[model samples]
Target: MSIQGSALPARPYRAFLFDMDGTLLNSIAAAERVWSTWAERHGLDVAAFLKTIHGARAIDTITRQALPGVDPEKEAQWITEAELDDVDGVVAIPGAVEFLNGLPGDQWALVTSAPKALALRRLQAAGIKPPAVLVTAEDVARGKPDPACYVLGALRLGVPVQDCLIFEDATVGIRAGEAAGADVMVVTSTHLTPMVTAHACIDGYEHIHVQRDSDGLLYLQRLAS
Candidate 1:
């Protein structure tokens, strides 16, 4: 399905669950550069390989490739280290910092495929504060496309997964959020090509507003373009 610019529903979502790399910030350049180098080292097609890396754990991505003599765990660690050292082009998605800061600290969580250290480094580079409830690659046995991470994120925030809204920018993450029974909103800031998805999309958080009620429940409002 083609992406729709439809405003999200005005559900009284209890908490927000955000995907890090693309939804909260743009780290595409830094991430692709590191992955490209790794791909080249493994004699893999850089472009093709990069297409599969986003929204997935490094170890899972490497394990799927079945690269000869490559230890997925070790290679994943190397990738994480390289990513940690290369935050050159990382930047917040438009209005992301403000959007995040306005939310109640305990009412939001970050669910990311990047390991905790690398996730922290990228968030620092982008000027986004680390979320109180962070579910990183090491926190789950599986990654995006699997609901474990999102499930755990909502769990940690003390919210029911069904009462949370997930913001994501990749197919795998969208699927994960849906599988976890949360509503999904797509962030389109880093799209290299038009994305096709059934979820409502926002290019950035500039026009998205949040209001917290007296009961502390959150509601989202998107301004008309």
Candidate 2:
């Protein structure tokens, strides 16, 4: 990652694509509470399981576990219900509310591994409004690590995938954005330790600013440290 506070290039990005959980908001506390409980019930290592869960759909993760006698779909549904009931600690990442509010309503989209209702609940808890375009788990057959969500997000915004900038915080999401041919800005707000990546990274939206040209194209820049 470019940790020296490099400014984003002056490209004519037409839309901003954001991943919800760790990018726009912090829901780790609530998510871990439910997932850890589920992990313990399944006799899995809580910490390791938590690491694998982020940026993946519940069903996808559960299917990968291949827990004996457990139906992946049913287990995923249980996890979803638990998460929906537990948004107590959800809150916006620093400057997320202001940053999102400043964007033109139609110029951005939310693409998340979370289900639609859960996504809305978390956004509400974080004090961020739902975007004009939201591509949730229900909207796609596959989740992160698959570029479909990101591609669909850009399509819904009426922009070419290459003309969009994606904000993501996880490896799976970064891969998805890159595969969709969009520039990605890694958000490390939820990271517990430093990570090495090829894309430009930001800890939060506090120092980032957006500009719109006469033709309505958007540009992102970083305020000098």
The TM-score measured for candidate 1 stands at: 0.97
Question: Candidate 2's error at 101, in angstroms?
Answer: 0.7
lDDT of predicted model 2 = 0.91
- Model 1 C-alpha lDDT per residue in residues 21-75, reported as the tens digit of each score: 9999999999999999999999999988899999999999999999889999999
Worst 10 residues of 2 by lDDT: 1-10
| Candidate 2 C-alpha error for residue 165, in Å | 0.3
- Predictions in order: lDDT: 0.91, 0.91
Q: lDDT score of model 1?
A: 0.91
Minimal lDDT window, size 10, model 1: 1-10
Candidate 2 lDDT, tens digit per residue, 1-225? 235345566687899999999999999999999999999999999988899989989999999998899998999999999999999989999999999999999999999999898999999999999988999999999888999999999889888999999999988999999999899989988998777887878889999889999999998877777
- In each prediction, how many residue pairs overlap at the backbone (N, C-alpha, C within less than 3 A)? 0, 1
